[model samples]
Target: VAAPARRGRALTAAVVVAALVLFAVGGGAGFALTRALAGASLLPPPSAGAPSLPAITDEAPARVTTASAATANGEQGAEFTIEVGADWTSFLEQRANRGLAPSTVVHLVAPTGGYEVSVQRFADYYPRHSVEDYLSLVRSRWPKGQYFGEATDVTDPLDPAAPEPPVQFSYRTVEKATELGRAADAGGRDLRRSRYSRVLPRGADLWVVEVVFPTEQEEMGRSRLFDTIAGTFAVVG
Candidate 1:
């Protein structure tokens, strides 16, 4: 059986800003209280009679939509909006991928569990080249994964006008996950690498947008949540 996939990238400092948005209303007081509690002695364990925290499950998908502004300029530049589960919130604590253009990024977090997803845009340095070329460049940086499978177009179900476009594909790769600082998990990260990418054509300019998510859905053998979120991805002018 194929091993489960894991998250590959680190959360960038800029992305961390999103995580604080919800907490910003509480101000520094909430942060100060958390720190104070952490410094104090360990609290006693809860009694057996105490209620336990609810288990994290992927059986049902959450309904939440968050819109991000269009990055590429001009009449043909692509713009998009995505919806994540309501249980998931903004995950600001993500590391920046220096290779990508820091135009716009949306990170989502599973409040009840440790799952995250992100959408980011990268400038198309080789506007003259084909979309395949860009996909190859991005894959090259991911040296760890053993990629397998041919690229297939991810078409727009809502728009029949955009037919058989090679802007998206079915990408798969397997790689060791980053567990501890150095210890690598035996499970793979192919599912994580199953991100959806597209090149936005803005006149002569090109921009790439990527939607990334944890393999949590796959881990639970559930796909509804992932599919639900992915359904909202769009590249528009």
Candidate 2:
């Protein structure tokens, strides 16, 4: 199969777009700057009918990075790994040693302009008590949202108060998630899933590296992806 069209990892456009639009609407300058660092692929226009988010990177001029990594979660535990072009070097270099979960997904915006790092967990699901809520609740642009014990702030560069809600209402609420089986594409080509998508700045690309296993070995499939991400980690500068 062909490689996934990810300016970041092997992530398909749908995944990136959903994630990108989710954050862009809530975040302003921070959102713009983040997409710029993600390579031009993240500059797509937000979904038409949905609440809109600006696509600033599409107009900006910048030099992005592309890189290859062994693991996103240092050496401890990880279910999957992701690598982008040289554009993402600074982000990977800075936060490689943080405490990451087994199914953790680590994302880095550019560092030049204040970068926003977005992460999603594999094992943990919705609810404020879950790991996902814990990370989004932290104050980045504004005083963190008042909500607790629920999935909140899946988007970055979020505005505390605004008409356009940037973050995607938790997956638990928005859409039904399908657990994918194990698969491999050495080339990491493009794919479209119900998940999400992103529009890059310009001339850049995006990809998502997922940990997939056959439908038969469900638990083992997830475990394999986790190990792959943890062991094959690298910090490209």
Candidate 3:
């Protein structure tokens, strides 16, 4: 009887040890899984407030420089003079960098004062075409509803004996956003006025003097200024 009791007791002790080992293994696996899942949840997501990249619109403005007439009129054979307004240096500047041919002797711009003046020289390549024909070609390029006034004869002090006086044509055009859109719907009144004079001296290279304004409300001011300048314009040769 004592021997059987000893054997039963050993079997019961082995069963309890085996149960404890299985329980410990299962608990360790569960603990490890819980840590992995919780670690993922606690980790922060990617941030959205990082610094923005630089863009093209952030570039600096153009550098402004003074222009001297002596430098502008220094072109080889197209030297000429133009009258400038009083206090002109405060209001206007010559566009030294404007894309013009070497024959384009002078170009002036005044954004605040609202005008642009340019003097260009061209060879008499179109001697067959009359001034009227040339002016018609220019007017044909205007948009619809733009006004093109009649061409007027300009008195050429340099050439009084020519058959017809040099021609001057004036025109007014409104800036069109598109072919179908109305000017009012586009924005404020952006009226444009242009004066083009074909200077025909007896034995001089053909020249064109142009003045333009963004708005016609100040037409008188610009007209007077341009007339003053054109009256004084003289050819070097």
RMSD, every candidate, angstroms: 23.1, 29.1, 19.1
Candidate 2: TM-score? 0.21
Query: Which 10-residue window in model 1 sums to the lowest lDDT?
Result: 1-10
Give the residue spans of candidate 1 off by over 4 A: 1-61, 69-79, 91-103, 112-115, 122-129, 144-150, 157-166, 173-193, 196-222, 234-237
Model 3 agreement with the true structure over 68-174: per-residue lDDT tens digits: 22324454444555655433332222322212222333566553445556665543324444445445555666756776554566565555754345766566666
Give the least accurate 10-residue stretch of model 3, judged by summed lDDT: 50-59
Clashes (backbone N, CA, C under 3 Å), per candidate, total 10, 68, 0
Candidate 2 lDDT tens digits, 15-71: 888888977776876776777887655557654332222222322333333333324
lDDT, each prediction: 0.49, 0.32, 0.52
Residue 56, model 1: lDDT of 40
Q: Which pairs clash in the backbone of model 1?
A: 11-94, 11-95, 12-94, 12-95, 12-96, 15-92, 16-92, 16-93, 19-92, 79-236
Q: After superposition, how far is residue 188 of candidate 2 from its true place, in Å?
A: 43
Q: Which ten residues in a row have the lowest lDDT in candidate 2?
A: 197-206
